[model samples]
Target: MANKFIIRWITLCIVLVVASIKPIEADSDRFNACFESCNEKCKNDDYGNAYCEVKCDFDCGAKEVSAKFNIAI
Candidate 1:
């Protein structure tokens, strides 16, 4: 009985992992697009890569929030 319970738990974990991967795969294109936009804008920055990355994140977050509220950032 203990072995059967362990097997079921393992099976459930495996199924959950398989189910979760598909949505992340589907979102890869959008992720890549956002990364590319950040990369381009950050490339010419005077503060260098690290600072630009932080700035890009802030900019993206602000854009998303403003867009969510139907306002332009």
Candidate 2:
């Protein structure tokens, strides 16, 4: 019984992790796009939008990278 419980717990954990992976990948892609957009704004010398976008993109990209790293570790 104990072994069965452990097996079930492990199975559930794996299922949850697998289910979540797609969304995390999607978020990472989105943040990457945001970073690109921010870069474009900076290149265009749109300082006002660039300033805001850079900060937002940085925060978003950081979170995505952190989450992806944590999963890898």
Candidate 3:
């Protein structure tokens, strides 16, 4: 019984780890896209570097949170 319990616990941990990994990749892709657009605007002096950073974080966080919660952004 103890061995079975240990196997189940390990299985749960592996599943959780795999599930969490997918979101990291998705978030990375979102950030990359945001960076590209922000870089272009920053190059033109549309906003300061700080503003770009804030926008990138806000945009990426909003997207990830909405997707994770199944809420429409």
RMSD to native for every prediction? 6.0, 9.6, 5.2
**TM-score of each model, paired residue for residue:** 0.44, 0.34, 0.48
> lDDT per residue, candidate 2, 1-73, as tens digits?
9999999999999999998785434575677776777667676775677576767677667766777688532
Candidate 3: pairs in clash: none
User: How would you encode candidate 3's per-residue C-alpha lDDT over 1-73 as one tens digit per residue?
Assistant: 9999999999999999988785334567766787777667765876787787877778777877788779998
Candidate 1 per-residue lDDT over residues 1-73, each given as its tens digit: 9999999999999999998785312344554567668867788665688777777767666665565578965
Candidate 1 regions off by >4 Å?
Answer: 1-32
Q: Which ten residues in a row have the lowest lDDT in candidate 1?
A: 22-31
lDDT per prediction? 0.70, 0.72, 0.77
Question: Of models 1 and 3, which has the larger lDDT?
Answer: 3
Overlapping backbone residue pairs in candidate 3 total 0
Please list the residue runs of candidate 2 whose C-alpha ends up more than 4 Å from where it truly belongs after superposition: 1-47, 71-73
User: Cα lDDT for residue 66, model 1?
Assistant: 64
State which candidate has the highest TM-score. Answer: 3
List candidate 3 stretches off by more than 4 Å. 1-26, 42-45
Best by lDDT: 3
Instruction: Supply the TM-score for candidate 1.
Output: 0.44
lDDT, candidate 1, equals 0.70
